[model samples]
Target: MKKIVSLLLTATMVLGLAACGNTDEETPETPETPGEEETLTGTGEGYGGEVTVTVTMDGDTITNVVAEGPDETDGVGTPALEQLPEKFVEANSADVDVIAGATVTSRGLIYAMKNALDPDANPWPMVEEEEDPSNVEASDVALGFGISSLGRKGPGADDTETQVWSINEVLASALFDGEGKIIYLNVDQVEVATPNYDGEGMPHLSGWPGQGGYNIDEDHDEKVDGVTEDTEENFIAEVELWKTKRERGDDYKMGISTWSEQMDAYEETFVGMTVEEIEEWFEKYTSDRNGRPLKEGSEDAEDKAKYDALSAEDKEMLADVTTSATMSLNDSHGNIIEAIRKAYENRMGLEITEAEAAGFGVSFMPRIGPGKDDQDVQVYSLNQVFANTLFDEEGRVVAIHVDQLEVASPNYDGAGMPHFSGFPGQGGYNYDEDHDEKVDGKTEDTEENFFSEIESWMTKRERGDDYKMGISTWAEQMDGYEEVFIGKTVEEIEEWFDKYTSDRNGRALKDGSEDAEDKAKYDALSDEEKAMLADVTASATMSLNDAHGDIIKAIRASFENREVINLSVN
Candidate 1:
């Protein structure tokens, strides 16, 4: 019976292929011309352009299938196009799952293949039904954070300099109701940079030693002779501007009426709407259904007519908020949907274990450097620490573990002279492993010990080069600091950080000061260790403050909004 079914399917495919000629209209099958392989071609509309598929068949079995969609997004759609042809040949049918996230492109390729193999037949697969959020009954808030860093290893030359590193961090949170409806959404993004270093790892002013050199004036409009309080003030103002843009609405100057209209349209389209419904609405705006560009004021009359006919809700979904504020409503909607899904799971009394409730914290050394060349080479030793805290259902931390990584370019020795060889050649230490278990009789390696290791490493790399200053690793300092954070609520952590990390003067809380206990461990280090500690303590304090501070802020913001919603409901 299986064999009979297979024969019948093969016969059906042959007849279908014969009907699918070069054009849509049926053409008589040509007798085999000398040295010509049987090939059929078809095209289907894709996300950005048409996707074409060519199929070559030997009798009833498909020998080859080639699909191409050049206009599609490279990482998202190209992968689907590259892999789907093989899938079709293996299955001998176009019935397959669309590549996750690249649905439109995958559908286009599949439709093209179906047209090539069987234009007259209904070879398209049935659309998957979206989960109905209306029936979902439980809701909870979930926060998601992502951090990415990019670095380049380079040696500076007389004519060129390298941008050593940069980091970008994003934090997003959403609140979902019992029905899996997103009630609130927020996102914050921050970026920081490291200084450019020379061949021997010595820090240099980028574009220095010339008129109109590297330093910027108060306005940051052009280079200046020197930096002053104004430079710091200006830099702070720029950071504030970036933060505002991320936290609030975009800074673009749209007409007040237009802005109000867009806001009203968004509220009408999305408020109290389920994720599925919101997605369907966005699809309409994104789709080129009438074979016309969906942008406002399209040149094509039909396209312009279609745009004009769209409801205000559709227009708002398609609206572009200036070139700089280019994030699409579709992207924001997706995030809200994910948050809703997570909230729905939590409301359903899903057993979320300690591992599932665990939160991760990350801290980078020198969180905000004075814009590259503001500090000396020795101060450039950078470290990143990632810590995860597993929490019980009661929201108490059950377990905590930390891993740290550090990198340093070449730097000046104790004499304030550049090292002969920089970075990869001088080689930095991995404090996580290469340090002594016990230093100066303190037992477990601490920040002072880590700094001692760094000094020793730096000293040995260049003979006669000594770093006699007091040294303190951010990790060692954070060891005691971490204790203050453990078992505390995120809000408590934020309060503690704001009060204890820095003094009234904005310096690291010193040994014998109000937060002396945290500093006492460092004070016990040798005279040289104390001196080495001086340069980094302030920067490390600021860095630690920013890293943990941001996480706490994100959590606090999420819960605060959650509370507001609950109050309104009550």
Candidate 2:
């Protein structure tokens, strides 16, 4: 009876509409069936995984959206997922403002939404016309980046002292005005183990995480403190978890203020000064012990009190800066001043008007050369790559700064200058020319060189000509390679690497390789390919992906994770 009543009502409504139209062939456009809502779903690729977008639409307008990308990074991608869904609804369109430091995830969410709304209309790979860079005004400002490392001793197994490699970096582009004054800066710090660093350093596999992960149950896969199984997965996981002190943000407890807050205070204090002036300012006001601003009022008997003591005028000059950043920016903490000074040395012509973004990246990988060697003589090597890039609004690289560092255990030096390949529990020897015997850097520890050897892990850029790479220094070659990176997109840079590099060893295709396979591969390449990379090979012939460094990975990541900023070009 209810179905018959509904059929009668529907027929009556149709008859009324037909009477108003006065035509049998006329049909009315149904408006979303009145009070009915439609749900849609779409997916797109994210940084480390896939992003799925679900939306409920009220007619043609987006009423609600939910984006999920569980595999995205904790601080980067997760934030985007939690934040962008609301923005999608507010905009009522797939196009929305991008979240800073998560460009890859932003694209994922946008594309997913586009497909969800109308896959047929929007297409899977929607292309948009790019705004020409020439149409935008050329910028007058330049930018730079830097990282520095100093080592110290910390507690090891039981109560013994182990080497702790302290590393600090400033990414920032240190946006400079035409007069060469700094207008912007971004700083962060991370320390790595020099054999076995304390819990304060980078996410060390065998040192801290290994110790904890080893005890965390059967499901964990890390190589625990020299006991668990070692694999590439373990190292990669460690790298993935590593974060700078600034990235740690509020998690890096400082009692009075966060690490980022302290750095921000200092960054603000240093702006408007040239690098030379900054050095002069540091020389006059910073504490010798902790690198904080000199204080005038503390009278306690501690070493810090003595370091903090200052005269009236000197303290007055630093009065403004001292209040906000009382913590150390030194080896005791993070050497931000030194990093900035080094940054000035590496400045490049990167013009950007309020529309560009910058990013800093470091590729750290542990290298263990397997096969062939005595168990009595071996050491560990840590290769680190640091890069800072400025990206145009069109997503092309505007400028870049890159440098690399290789640090080894003291025992590595004992092996030889070029190589100390062995398989073991031993330190190399230093030769005594007059005595014609193996000296200190010897198997046993000496009073003088023990502390000295542990505290000096220098970067290649600092070593300069000393880090000889055939006819060019490591710094010179790195600069040359950076020129090739400029003006290309990240995709282009990656494709260039694939085209010019050797798959076997991950280096440029060279004629003088020790391996016959590499030689054959180089010979097999067409003349066009060889000529394409000729300019690069002339300066940088070393492997970009081998044990030396992982530069391409760093380059890609710099773009993947960038912070958005705005400032007039000079």
Candidate 3:
């Protein structure tokens, strides 16, 4: 994205009126000695344009410098014209000083100083590069592979742009604010061929339905008419794909059905096979249809020859597959899961956990085509994802998908479907790991309900974050266990629990305080339970620290928005 500059100026006028009044007063004031005007001029150029200035003052500080030129880069030289004092502003000028990278602009400013008095007072140019000892120190140490692998390596300035644009479309909402949408479409088709019959004829692939074996293209009218005679094996398979487009607002969500069986077959069929075998199978499969084979030799040879004619580049290109499939996944349910993952990533400030990654459900497509004839096979996968959210003062995801997930699920099942297997016209196995009852007979609904319970507690107590409520709930539960839960030394808490459970016959802790063990637990209640806990006691403290870290991150973001250098024209 190109950087753009815009300038806005606001000025206010005030008028005051006073009723007629007459007063007689006599006062005399003597004129003091006129102070000498110490004149100082500075010219500096910054990231954008240049400005020059001359200040007339009586002290070490110039106190004021006016600038005129093309718009200066915000947060840069503009500070010189604002709140900065005279000494620093002069130091930032070209004749007196240059604002580093804006040297030319700084010179331009100095040249513009003709408007000021005392041309002979023009200061000779002195460009002194400020020594950044930090950089020098950094260079002194060898940042070898060990350090680089730790992600401590420095990146070029353009790397930030790349990160922004890697998933630019998704970030569009956050960056561009819903000016455009990113969509992903997927389509799948099979590149199938029959196996060649060796001297020892191989068993025809007819054991499974939907599997390519002993099958014929009944639609082949010429072959049906018996006009072609040939004998060959055939290989048949199904291809899945998808397509994504940026359209409408960002809230658009699309999905499709995927049959992993086809994928499984693909893995078994072509993934590990040599190119020779693939071609042979294509020939034999295309030749033999039903019980009859098409024209032999030259036709098959023509096909093989055509394939051979492809340049190495063509072969390399052909090996790739790209396509898309898109369907309205859930009209209003466009929260493409990317945001959830991002929230987790930002929250944790680390690579995602495997559980979180698995829940993300993002993948790629293998091949794509309009149908089968104009098949363009290219591997497609989800790149960077983005979302735009409309919040009301307080930040919260209201309308999701303000700019949905845009991925290129080419030539694969872009549709979010798991493997399906069951008796034909009957129930089949659902391979959806996310389906209800995924965890210990618990479904998404169960988790939702659990969170809902927590939410109820929050609403009742007016707590703002789930972590707060979760921690409170855990603290309450721990109340009936045996320790002064408040600031109890870690050892004390452990000891208390051990003593409380010493004679409990190793029974799991129950939810009431009817027994002696329960009373001991209740007596250990803390006034303020771990209000930031996410799991159990030990984990709760860690969670509180994590929440604090999140708060610190937000603070840092706020700090970054503030100007690094304070400038005033005084």
TM-scores for all predictions: 0.31, 0.57, 0.19
Residue-level lDDT of model 2, residues 1-570, one tens digit each, is 644876798899889886887666757576645546899998886666678899998766689998999877778677779899999999999889766546567778888998887798756555565543322222567777666554333322312322333334333347666677887677777743333442443444432211122211122232124332344456455645666665565546442345676677777778888878877777667766556666655453453464455566655666656544567766544466777876777677654444477777777776653211233333445577878787877777877778776754333422222221111122333222232222233433332343344334456776766777675888888887888888899899888787778887777787677788777877888888778667678887777787666899888877876655545463
Better of 2 and 3 by TM-score: 2
lDDT of 3 at 167: 10
Q: Can you write out model 3's per-residue Cα lDDT over 1-570, one digit (the tens) per residue? A: 111211111111111112323336533344554546677665544234345566665433244566654566554445444433353455633245434323334445555453343344543353455543211001111000000000001111121121100011111111110111111111121111111211111111211122223322234321221111121112112111211222111222111112222122322233223334434534443222221112213345644565566577654443321011122111111222232122222220111111100001111212121121113222222221121111211221112111112122112232331111211211222122332322222112222332222112111111112223343532332222212233333244344444333233322223354788655653565533322111234322211112111211222222222211111111
Colliding pairs, model 1: 447-476, 469-531, 469-532, 470-529, 470-530, 470-531, 470-532, 470-533, 471-532, 471-533
Worst 10 residues of 3 by lDDT: 143-152
**Considering lDDT, where higher is better, how would the candidates rank from best to worst?**
2, 1, 3
lDDT of every model, 2 decimals: 0.42, 0.62, 0.26
RMSD of each: 22.0, 14.2, 29.1
| Clashes per candidate, residues 3 or more apart or on different chains | 10, 2, 84
Worst 10 residues of 1 by lDDT: 202-211
Deviating ranges (above 4 Å) for candidate 1: 1-171, 177-181, 187-242, 246-252, 255-268, 271-280, 286-516, 519-563, 567-570
Candidate with best lDDT: 2
